[model samples]
Target: MAETSLTELLERNARHVESLDSDHFAGVEDTQAPVAVSICCSDSRVPHDGMWDVTHPGWLFTPSTIGNQVWDIHDGERVVDGSLLYPMINTRTNVTLVVGHTGCGAVSAALDAVQNGPGMVPAGIEKWVDLIVPVVEAGLNDERIDADRDVSLVDQLVEYNVDRQIEFLLESDDVPETETVYGFVYDFQGVYSDERGRAYLVNADGETDVAALRELAPTKYHDAVDRLLQ
Candidate 1:
């Protein structure tokens, strides 16, 4: 198959726009209504809309970053407080979804930086990946995690990063009290068993236990908790 050109991509988007009716976004304009804010990884395989099964526009405000990591490093960092959190706070969105995925390139890069050094990658990338040092350290220090095995450490970091981001949001005063945040790891490989299409419920309302997760999570996620947490 031939690679698609810029012209083709533009024409395709134009065709999609032309096909939309005038009422496409009828009730969504000029309002700061409650919407779902999703912070996910910048991986094309994990399409936010498709994952949520949302076909309509304006239902979800998605801000994707590398490894789906959120930080409170300082005021107005473009990735954290500027673009993603600003909109979430301004819109007063009631739910914040912090999603991480398996096989994340950013997570891999972070691991490499931790094992090797910051000089292994570009300067900008080194700093960004360094933000995840705590997560990597936690994984390395944990007795249960086998750091020698690539998959074990990578998977642990992926889930840990999601939990870490959720914790950051919960600690922030900018986040509304009415907001309910959830953390999830989108494991295309299920249960650490190489199965696919599982959304593991790692954290809910600041709780990571199976009991707390069971109370708040949908029935679909119960099995994931059991399998993945096992």
Candidate 2:
């Protein structure tokens, strides 16, 4: 069978969007209240809406970046203080999720950078990949991390990157100390996963425990756990 051209694919997809009722916008326009804000990677495989579907429905405001890493600046009153963190905080969303993903091209490139030097990749991509190198290095130092297996290494890197981005979000002023923050990694299959199978949670200190935290605070903790994985 012949593969459809890019133009044909896009034209078909555009028709799908145009078919939606204009009234669909009106139904959501007045209800701008977002219960949570999700920060995830630019990976097309991980859809924010689909992930959030695991939880009860409410409008979720999401901000996506290439690497899902937030950079914090001290000495400012900025809410959601990081570059990608503010939108959710400004919305005063009850929860914030920093989401990374497995098999990320950016992380892979970053690993390549460390192995082959930065010259091998483009300049702009190198900058984004640089953000993840520290996590790669950390994985390298951890005895449990398997540097030999590409899948294991990528998963570890994704988890570590989520932890780092969550820490960055926590530093933001918009993120209340009382407000819950989460870290998650979406796998290639679009299923969220932890160290176990699919989907896990990071505690306030960024430790993974699916059961313990759920037992402590059912509602808030479960929401945090689910959203992070999403």
Candidate 3:
């Protein structure tokens, strides 16, 4: 099965090469100034570039990790991961977008780890999940979250997690205050609304107020900008 999938991948790459124009990436070959640097969960369902309909190579800089975590353990300290920082420092990328999706397996694992004591897992996977466990614990303490409710706990945790990640980004000295951070929860389970696959703006520069978020967005998306926890 793996061999078949690998063959399909090569064939798909051949088709992609055939469809490309001569100058398709010529403009960005030397340098790149992407619209935004997006950090999202390592989920197969979420397409970081496709969400923005970005086909051009240099338009979006994507750095993904488990649980959509911005920080990684390095030498016994949690620091901003290099994959997310390298683009901002060199590519003139200012806008930082942190995207979390509903039904995130990472967040679910963290929730379980927090509630039931962590089960033994691979060390690398445990690192990311361990970071998220505290966020889940904090979310549970917040009045907005409920283990049982109309909105599923996992979905609510996903939104809360997005906000937490943005907060971490904002507080980091490594990240310039001049850079704007936008947090979004990509809804695919009809949890935020009936519109599946809609990326809802939940936080901007640490502001989670729905009214403020609506104002931050274009008038057309005001109704769409929503926070599940609130």
Candidate 4:
């Protein structure tokens, strides 16, 4: 038989669940445990479990959506509030991660929509992209930044989107005041970028001193957590 596509593979696996070992279902009902919540893009390539393993280890609670935009209102009416915000506030997971990526189709489409016109984007998509337009505007307004640089302005916009989303998360009532939140950009190569280069962690709070983070003894990641804890 020919190789199966991922969807088909998943379907096939689901069919074989009855014959699988008992351990597959063991401890499956443990719902009280706390987890680190990660809000990432809906892109299939960006696997949250694998990314967190390389960056921050152990169990995590992850929520995903296209564009990674978390807004309280939807379609001019508050239908869903913010997706991950409520969970962060109510659940044991206090830490939240807003992960963005390079070459994001949504970000690129939004930039194009702003430059040209909404064109083919439907009303819902247009509304969603509108949440990220300010980041694109910020990237465009930065004189020292070149839109055509090696990483491209769109990539920078994606990074900025992550930062802005973090701000949105912070401003929401659903996010606990004491909780720690982080933002990062996952590049096309799966590398997270920061001012410190391919960093796995980037402090979304603009107040963090980049120079001090770079000079930390153990690692920038550790120092970032320390700063937040302080």
Candidate 5:
């Protein structure tokens, strides 16, 4: 970033620190017990804390990856990302949310790699993109999503990616069964019928049934509970 932009960012941080109370982080300074572990894409467009309305620090545990895939490549094998598992195993966090978004650049890149070729990218970025390629391939071949998708192919694949990540989390033997995984697509581009930033609860504990998700979600999240692909 430019020097001016970096200065502006630090100035913003200074303002934020000054705005907070001295005891804002008193309890969590020593120990943390987050309620949910959010594995979201590292997309600036997708507001992580603001979207969830999380102002407090300890309520939610945030872990972001390039495409929000739950697993990472290591020694030619896929292993669950440490950031997503540490809180689940060590802290009181039992709920896990795999949040994807419409028109995701990561999913688009993976789709391109699957359809075309792995085109030039840095080695670090290529790793995450490589992991997402299979999910794009699966979404392309899935008969259910083909029939259920109402948005563009990329947007549909975004939701499909969320499902795949949640699947990875659920199947991992290291993950506790009590840690429920919830899949959501943050619709900031009006892909779904809800409002501008409606976080659609696409899957709950691997269950993609929209009607069943309504039962699992609270009444306030009734509007947020929906599915584009059954």
Candidate 6:
């Protein structure tokens, strides 16, 4: 198979842009009025639009970064803090979602860096990946993950990191208590009833109770919810 050239890629993109009709954006408003703010990983497979089945442009205030790690680094001067605050300030959004996924390269790289040591993966990149070192360590300490078992520590860290990120956001003074925050895990392995890449609610409004979380999970994911609670 021939590799697609930059010219071909640009032409394809231009064609797509030209094909978009006015009707496609007819319902979109000029003002920033979104239902929720979504913080997710920069993984290509898990696009924010598909998570909420978004059809309109302003349905979600999306901010994606490496591993979707949120922290009070540098006294709230980091990009993650600004990204979360931007939607809250500009949009009429009441819900905040911290989403992570299975098969996340960022989480895996962070796991490797923590287990071993930060290697030559560029100075800035290494710093960003190092943010999840605590998460990786927590996952490693979890009694559920046995070294002899087939469990992927990286996947465990992904879910745990989402919980930690949500915890950080909820504790932030900038985040109003009126706004609901949720932590979710996007399962890409069809683990939830053969539906690939479905968003499963792990934490709702800072509550991680199994029963409360079970109430939020879709009926199709009831079995998966049991596994998550286990």
Which model scores highest in lDDT?
3
Poorest 10 consecutive residues of model 2 by lDDT?
190-199
lDDT of 2 at 201: 58
Question: Against the correct fold, how does model 6 do in TM-score?
Answer: 0.85
91: Cα error in model 1, Å = 0.8
In angstroms, the error of model 1 at 81 is 2.5
lDDT of 2 by residue, 1-230 (tens): 76789999999999967876766555456556577777777777778888767332347776776677565225652234354444454556767777777677777777777787875567666666776777677756766556675345666677767776776556656556655776666655443433332334554445456565566556744744642221
lDDT of model number 1: 0.73
Name the regions of candidate 2 deviating beyond 4 angstroms: 1-22, 27-31, 54-58, 72-83, 148-151, 189-199, 202-205, 214-230
Question: Model 3, residue 32: displacement in angstroms?
Answer: 1.6
Clashes (candidate 6): 0
User: Quick one: RMSD of model 5?
Assistant: 2.0
Question: Each candidate: what lDDT?
Answer: 0.73, 0.63, 0.89, 0.63, 0.88, 0.76
Task: Please list all clashing residue pairs in model 5, or write none if there are none.
Answer: none
- Per-residue lDDT tens digits for candidate 3, residues 59-133, read 999989999999987899878888898887777688999999999999999999988999899998998899999
lDDT of 4 by residue, 4-88 (tens): 6999988888987756676754553554334767887878767787765633333576778768776646567533235576567
Per-residue error for 136 in candidate 3, Å, reads: 0.8
Q: Model 1: how far is 152 from its true place, Å?
A: 2.6
Model 5, 114-203: lDDT tens per residue? Answer: 889998999999988988998999999987666344678888899989988888888899899898888999989998874788888899
Candidate 6 residue-wise lDDT, 29-50, digit = tens: 5566888999888887888998
Question: Where is model 4 more than 4 Å wrong at Cα?
Answer: 1-7, 10-21, 24-30, 54-58, 74-81, 190-199, 204-208, 214-217, 220-230
The sequence of per-residue lDDT tens digits that candidate 1 reaches over residues 43-128 is 87788887788777888888887778766366544235555676677877788888888887888887887787765667766666
* Candidate 6 lDDT score at position 21: 78
Q: How many pairs collide in each candidate, listed in order?
A: 1, 2, 0, 0, 0, 0
